[model samples]
Target: MELQLALDLVNISEAKEVVAEVAEFIDIVEIGTPVVINEGLHAVKAIKEAFPHLRVLADLKIMDAGGYEVMKASEAGADIITVLGVSDDSTIKGAVAEALKQGKQVMVDMINVKDIEGRAREIDAFGVDYICVHSGYDHQAEGKNSFEELAAIKRVVKNAKTAVAGGIKLETLPEVIQANPDLVIVGGGITGQSDKKAAAAQMQQWVKQA
Candidate 1:
């Protein structure tokens, strides 16, 4: 499993500092939706330019106009762009097509999709790069997680690599790793810790060992 560091609620500079602290431990740096809203695609560009080696994912969580949005994010140097799975199939198709043309990738976020397995099965046919089971902040506040949903999708999704996100932390990481997801996404798990590098390093070590 690969480790993805999610940067949410941070500006361009803070995001840089955080990533620089744990750069060696992370496989991907995520420019989260809030960061995108505050800084625009410039956040993606700045991060990608700063760290050309690490892959950068722009969390657009796009719901429509997938092709145009993907094109814009790809232009800003995003290696992977996200789209909401609840979006129409055509939207996913458009995003996938645009990403392929841009030589980038699309990760479908199943944030609130009611039928995880069913929709994942269908989206797998669209040939997206990743299918992520996610629980939004609100869902997390309600003490919810996507572990079960992750398991649900793993059983059916064949074409896309699987990812799991939503409140994942160092303590709970072993449980996540046991599921053997292709990617493990952590936000506050590392960012909120007293020692970000240690947390990221430990998580990366565990993932690599797993």
Candidate 2:
């Protein structure tokens, strides 16, 4: 399993500082939707420029103009870009095609997709690099999680690597690891900690063991 640190609420400088602290522990540094919205793809560019060794993901959650968006993000140095699972199949395929052309990747985020298993199977067939099971902040506030959803995708997805995200914490990470997701995304779990580096190190150890 690979550990991904989601930098959602931080500014460009803060994101850089936090990643510098835990860079060795993480495989991917996610410039989250909010960060991208706030700082634009400049956030992706800056992070990748600063940490050239680590993979950077731009969480576009793209719902339209898939090919163009993927191309733009890839040009901005994003190693992987995201598209909504609920988007049209053409959109997903467009994103994947662009990503392939750019030598990057597309992660289909199954946040609000109702038929996760069925949709994941379809998206997997579309050649997405990763099919992510995610619960947004709103759903997480209602005590919803992607654990079960992750399992559902794992059971059905054949071609794509599986990822899980949504309020994952140190205590709950083992549970997520039990499901064997290819990527485990953690945001507040590491960012909200008093000692971010130690927290990330511990989480990385757990994921490595898992």
Candidate 3:
């Protein structure tokens, strides 16, 4: 289980707290789209600058002018920049190209993508690091861990690495890993708790046992 700690509220202090707590445990620290859209690229820079050791994933969720967004996030020290899966093929192509030139990583986020299989196949040729299966905040409030969609996403992408997020918890984590996601994300499950570090540590143990 490659843990991704999500920073959604966009507070640098909150982000720093989570990082300080999970720095030794989590693999990737994500600057969520909500946070980025609210706070701009500094959210990514602040998190990256604060925790330089951990890998930073900027959830820019770019939908247009892909190259500019990717380049901007990359310059902000984001190791990985994400673009919306619903974006036009040309936009995705442009983002991927910029990422390559910037020596950065690209992740295509499948948030509300109409045709998961068709979209996945469309961008399979792009040099992407992860095919992120995401659930926005509104959908998460409704109920979570749509294992069915996750399974379908995994089935479609045979080559690109997989990632899944959306209100995940300890018990549901096993079912998520069963889908063979390269990364399993948990935001409130950890950060929402009183002890973020202990929350991370507990998850660390769970993944090791898993």
Clashes of each: 0, 0, 0
User: Runs in model 2 with CA error above 4 Å?
Assistant: none
Candidate RMSDs in order: 0.4, 0.6, 1.6
Cα error, residue 10 of model 3, in Å, equals: 4.0
Model 2: lDDT to the true structure? 0.96
- Candidate 1 CA-lDDT value: 0.97
Query: Which lDDT tens digits does candidate 2 get at residues 2-111?
Result: 99999999999999999999999999999999999999999999999999999999999999999999999999999999999999999999999999999999999999
Q: Is candidate 1 or candidate 3 better by lDDT?
A: 1
Better of 2 and 3 by lDDT: 2
Tens-place lDDT digits, model 1, residues 1-210:
899999998999999999999999999999999999999999999999999999999999999999999999999999999999999999999999999999999999999999899999999999999999998899999999999999999899888999999999988999999999999999999999999999999999999998
Model 3 CA deviation exceeding 4 Å by range: 208-210
RMSD of 3: 1.6
- The TM-score of candidate 2 is 0.99
Clashing pairs in 3: none
Q: Which runs of model 1 end up more than 4 angstroms from their true locations? A: none
lDDT for each residue of candidate 3 in 112-190, tens digit (9 for 90 to 100): 8878878887777776778887877888887754566678777878777888888887667777766777787888888
Alpha carbon lDDT at 26, candidate 3: 92
